[model samples]
Target: MAHETSETTAASSVDAAASSGRRFLRNKVPEVTVSFWIIKVLCTTVGKTAADLLGEKAGHGLTGVSVLMSVLLAVVLVVQFRTTAYRAGVYWSAVALISVVGTLISDSLTDGMGVPLETSATVFAIMLAAVYVVWYRRERTLSIHSIDTTGRESFYWLAVLLTISLSSATGDLVSERMDFGYWLSAVLFALLIAAIALAHFALDLDAVWSFWIAYVLTRPLGASFGDYLSQPTDDGGLGLGTVVTSVLFLGVVLGLVVYPAVTRKDVTQLHQAARQAA
Candidate 1:
């Protein structure tokens, strides 16, 4: 009887450790809500303005800017992926850098190589759709709620990269080719995002679908907003310049990251609730 009890206790300890590890892996993605949207928009906006400032204002040119940002993004992503747990600062910094690189990719093709925005948009959309289809087929779930595994994180980043590229192409197409102007494009995207939000909250759309639709739209919305703030006064902007716009958004994002990191209040509460439900 004594021997049997000792074995049972040992087994229980092992099981507990395994369960804890599993839970840690599963909660990688941040919860989708107002704060998440706000930070995401700020990151994308910073991405657009910062990339322009580096490339045009700094005279690094498109290739130099693209290469520099791409290297930085890769380094950030390495740190982010290697992190055993989510660090808000690392994660958001990676996101901001990725946003800049994605925009650079599209811009290089469109402005440097003279590829049409319409063509780039179509190709990026197709690529993003393919990523989603494959991710779903393999994982059997597209829930951001369950991004704990390496495979899910891979899919998540791939989707994000493609969405950024597509959004850039589409935004440029509307603003430049269609001559809608920055302010008008921003208004149009804002309305579209509002419609998506309404559909999600009021009309009972699936959470995954609603989240993704909103995510894709936010990219263009951020791009348009950045353009509206940073473009020349003659171009209907506030004449703030890209440097000022980038700095403003970066400051906001830094504050958001720091708050979450220091408090850990949000993280603790979320995990506690998840434990209770489980």
Candidate 2:
């Protein structure tokens, strides 16, 4: 009897160790909450202004900036993928970089290929929808809770890229071509996002769908704000310059990310702990 009990104890210990290892492999994406949305918008604003700063103000030109941002994004994403756990810096840096790359792609389609902004926007929207459909079919859930696997993360980032690209094209098309102006465009998108939030919280809308809808809208919301601040006064902006706007938004992003890092307020496990205690 004693010999049999010892063997069972050993088997149980191994199982416990395996379970602990799996816990570390939980989904990496942060929770869908107000902080997440705020930082996302800030990152997108930086995406727009920083792209302009690199390509035009810094005189690297579109190709140079595109290559530079793409390389940086590749490096950041590699680091993010290697970790079994989420690191705030690596994750958010990847996002900011992917944002830059998305902006470059939209600009290339419009300026380099002479594709109309409205057409590019429509094309990107279709691509984003396709990603969502395939991702849902494969995963059976579009919830961020399902992002633990590498495959889900890939789909998530692809969708993010498409949203960023489409938002840029659509924002510029409305603000410049449609003459809505930067301020009005920002307000419009912001209101739409607000409605999504209201519907989700008050009207019992699906959490996942509401989160994604707001997520996509933030790209244009931020882009419009970036354009409003960075463009020349004659171009319907405040004439703050790309450099200033980029620096300002990037600083805010850095600060917000650092807070989450230090407090672990946005980290899934820690967030749950904090909530439980409250």
| CA lDDT of every candidate | 0.80, 0.81
CA RMSD per model (angstroms): 8.0, 8.5
Candidate 2 lDDT tens digits, 129-190? 99999999998877764466789989988998998998889888888899999999999999
Name the 10 consecutive residues with the lowest summed lDDT in model 1. Answer: 1-10
User: Could you give candidate 1's per-residue lDDT for residues 68-131 as a string of tens digits?
Assistant: 8889988988887787556788888888998999999999999899999989999999999999
If candidate 2 were superposed on the true structure by all CA atoms, what would the RMSD be?
A: 8.5
Using all chains and alpha carbons, the TM-scores for the candidates as numbered come to: 0.87, 0.87
Query: How many clashes show up in model 2?
Result: 0
Single out the weakest 10-residue window by summed lDDT for candidate 2.
1-10
Give candidate 1's whole-model lDDT.
Answer: 0.80
Where is model 1 more than 4 Å wrong at Cα? 1-26, 265-278
Please state the error at residue 182 of candidate 1 in Å.
Answer: 1.1
- The parts of candidate 2 lying over 4 Å away from their true place are 1-24, 58-60, 269-278
The lDDT leader among the candidates is 2
